[model samples]
Target: MARTLHLGAFLHGVGHHSAAWRHPESAAERLGDIAFFEESARVAEKGLLDAVFFADGHSVNRTYTAGTTWFLEPITALSAMARATSHIGLVTTVSSSFWTPFHAARMLASLDHISGGRAGANIVTSMFDAEARNHGFDALPAHAERYARAAEFVEALTALWDSWGEDALLVDR
Candidate 1:
């Protein structure tokens, strides 16, 4: 058997460069449009990529004036993308620091079902003080603390995701 290389498209607004929004052909102004996201996913699918990844931040950075800084919520946007494409995986950044394990598990599980198991979660221990403040923290936790919390979050989330056995949702009537 031959090994296969999996590829993922990181779909950041237009491009990943800070000045991508300034490019003449960039669709920077359409960051909030679901159609824009759908098109991006479709293009990724056309390329035979295994997944399209969406990065997310919970707070508005001060750099907003320089370029495109915000976008549609990741999980919500991925739901639309799931509807728009098949075969390509849908993955989103979700901060363990800002969300409860239950919330994350439920959302991811729903997205997984929606995409026929093509959904993925890119969990992060967020480092921004602004993200901390938005989640009710006065300051960002120490790196070790953040990682510790992330470990627990992942453990709990995995348990929740596994709570449902594979045949739990059988639909015989």
Candidate 2:
């Protein structure tokens, strides 16, 4: 089998460098604009990249002075990216801790439809007590608990997504 390297771009404001926003040519003013995001996706598509990825979190965790709290909500932004590109995949990080399995599955499934089957989700068992606190927990769940919940959540998601096959509407059952 021939080995192939898959490449994807992580879209952040201007760049990923900590000081990117400080650079004069970084176009820092366009941070939340969807056009900026679309352009990034379009470029990736032109470059024949496999996908464009967005990382998301439940809580704001950044130093105020440096201003790293720049994230457009992933699902919504990816929807826009879907419209702007034809072939490149749209992938987003979904924190399992923040969403019920059914809800997350529905959202991601819809994205797959919207993207013409190019949607992908990176389900994450989120870390950090601060992230947990925002979701009404005092502290991060125990390590085992986190993974356990994530495992169960994934099982539920798979079941939900797989519930209706192409022949699901047949009366042969």
Candidate 3:
């Protein structure tokens, strides 16, 4: 197979750099606007980009005075993005530490159906004690434990995703 480069826009709030929101051309105010996300997806598609990815978090670890942080839940935001573009893949980070495999599988499966199979995921074990606290952990789990949970999470999601047969959702009797 021939090697090819894959480019995905990070599509962070305003921009990746903390100071980007201060730029004259930056659409900082449009962070929560669906049109902003839709327009961004359109632009990436027009550029022939391969995908647009959104990173997510469960808790606020950074002060707003310091820098921009992502607000929209990745799956929800990407679900909206899925509606605005035809070809660009919609990818997002999903924390295995916080989300159950069944929930992740259900949401991603819907996204895949919505986007004509352009949905993708970057599963993560997550970082920060704040995020851990939000999910009911007293602190971040040990590294080995987190990785082991992540592995199991992936296995469960894969099983859930592949569990259905073609007729699973059949309406015709």
Ranking by lDDT: 1, 3, 2
When 1 and 2 are scored with lDDT, the better candidate is 1
Report clashes for each candidate as comma-separated counts. 0, 0, 0
Best by TM-score, which number? 3
TM-score, prediction 2: 0.91
Per-residue lDDT value at 13 in model 1:
67
| Candidate 2: segments with Cα more than 4 A from true spot | 63-65, 169-173
Best by lDDT: 1
Instruction: Give the local distance difference test score of model 1.
Output: 0.87
Per-model lDDT: 0.87, 0.86, 0.87
lDDT of 1 by residue, 1-173 (tens): 99999999998866787888888999977878899999999999999999999888888776543466657888889998999998899999989888999999999999998888989989998757887888788988899988999999999999998898989977988
- Collision pairs in model 3: none
How well is each residue in 36-115 modelled by candidate 2, as lDDT tens digits?
89999999999989999987777776643254444688899899999999999999998887789989999999999999
The alpha-carbon deviation from the true structure for residue 49 of candidate 1, after best TM-score superposition, in angstroms, is 0.7
- Candidate 1 deviant stretches above 4 angstroms: 63-65, 170-173
Clashes of 3: 0
Model 3 lDDT tens row, 67-158:
56787777787888888888899999999988889999999999999889999999988888888888788898899999999999999999
Clashing pairs for predicted structure model 1, backbone only: none
Models 1 onward score TM values of 0.92, 0.91, 0.93
Span of ten consecutive residues with least summed lDDT in model 1:
62-71
